[model samples]
Target: MTLLPKNPSRLIREDDRDSAVERLREAYAEGHLTHEELDGRLGRALTARTRRELGAALASLPEERAGTTSTIATAAGRIRRRGAWRVPRSLKVASAFGRVYLDLSRAVIEYPVVDIELRLGTGRAKITVPRDAIVDVEDLRTGWKDTLYKTRRRSRPGGPKIRISGIMGFGRLKIRHARR
Candidate 1:
């Protein structure tokens, strides 16, 4: 999906409101809209009494795309890598689906270590990393709130390194650094 600008001047025009609504409907039908997400965006799109306000809401819609996948491993083979590592976006249907495969695999013996790197075009990112690893988070864009949560930790030599970049809208990035 193409990333829309965080602030698009075209969204405020009276003529574009209808098209924006249509796009929202399309996105909803595609199963990309969660109840909360639909309600939030719809509320903004509808409650905006002025064209400018409506435009602002429409312009803030999230967009994202998955890039490449790579594997990283150490010679000792004590550590295993998994999960999609990348920025988060509004549209995560694909990522959610991909998780099933990740869960089922016992360890493709051929590649015991795999670190998937997902390239995000735009949107929020939520990440999870192992506890034994060190985490480094960098917010490339300003004015957005990004959070990290440590869920669990194991006695290991190192931790995971997570990074977030290219945030173009108003949203939050919540990460679980370890397992509780």
Candidate 2:
């Protein structure tokens, strides 16, 4: 059974192609694919058009395990993460009196689901998730200001799910999904 949908003929997205390339590189580094095979697959990956072609580039490669929880806490400073950083299974962020900016739009989130725990005493916290990500903030408790999340888009069938649970004492917490 293929992982793709029944039609499976849709054009692949740029992010999907990029992810496939990273997986191929990882497989080669792990000695799973030979140099010649890697070169051949890399060409197909870079020029892959449809989902089938993209999937083929990542076929037979073993999956990477999700890492343990990562914690980033600060008393009075800035905490930021962006670029192609690897996302772990769980993330705990605590800020007493500072700004926290977490941009997960370009982050590599391999897991199907992830949990983010936040504890903001007093400061602004901005989080940007992936476009196709599903965010849940049901368990979040806030005071002084309500959490701002204006996205209504649901995650794709195989997209990632982000669950946020935490307590905000006195500040604003804004969560926005990537528009790109």
Candidate 3:
């Protein structure tokens, strides 16, 4: 999604609604939202047709902290987290008919190993990690012609290890070292 300045008048996309729904789920998990409130907000979020509506759905939730574990899911939009964002100890990403990007070159890692759970249905995912990081994808299961590509890079001792475990139904999952 395009990272535009906070403009109230700009149109919201389906990805925005999905993001709002995720926030609502997080709020529910954090005890900030009751079951009824989460259901109502989720309904509004799924049916929201405008950015303002989506914003309203998430207005009551607290802002996400930088270092907390986050679950990012999307139905039909792109999900990309990059740059200097903090890498959660366990990050879960689920996508369908969308694209997922996890760039960990500049991420702050607090754990010696990060667990990444990826669920992709007819979507693609690209994970870029530092050359020194170790990536283990032994638990990944793919269906049909689904593909997973890992470009080799030297892995150093004591570097963060990324353990990926998930199910892939079609599409591709590519893991590459960050370009210098």
Give per-residue CA lDDT, model 3, range 96-120, as digits (tens): 8899999998776667999999888
What is the per-residue lDDT of model 1 for residues 1-180, given as tens digits with 9 covering 90 to 100?
Answer: 967556665435544566566556545645667667777877787666466667665664556334334333222212223432232222122221111112111111112222333323234445444444344444444344544445345546543333334332344445554443
| TM-score, cand. 3 | 0.60
Better structure of 2 and 3 per TM-score: 2
Full-model lDDT, candidate 3: 0.80
Candidate 1 shows a clash count of 15
Lowest summed lDDT across 10 adjacent residues in model 2 is found at 1-10
- C-alpha lDDT of residue 122 in model 1: 30
The models' CA-based lDDT, in order, is 0.42, 0.86, 0.80
Error of 1 at 7 (Å): 67
Query: What is the C-alpha local distance difference test score of candidate 1?
Result: 0.42
TM-scores of the candidates are: 0.29, 0.67, 0.60
Highest-lDDT candidate:
2
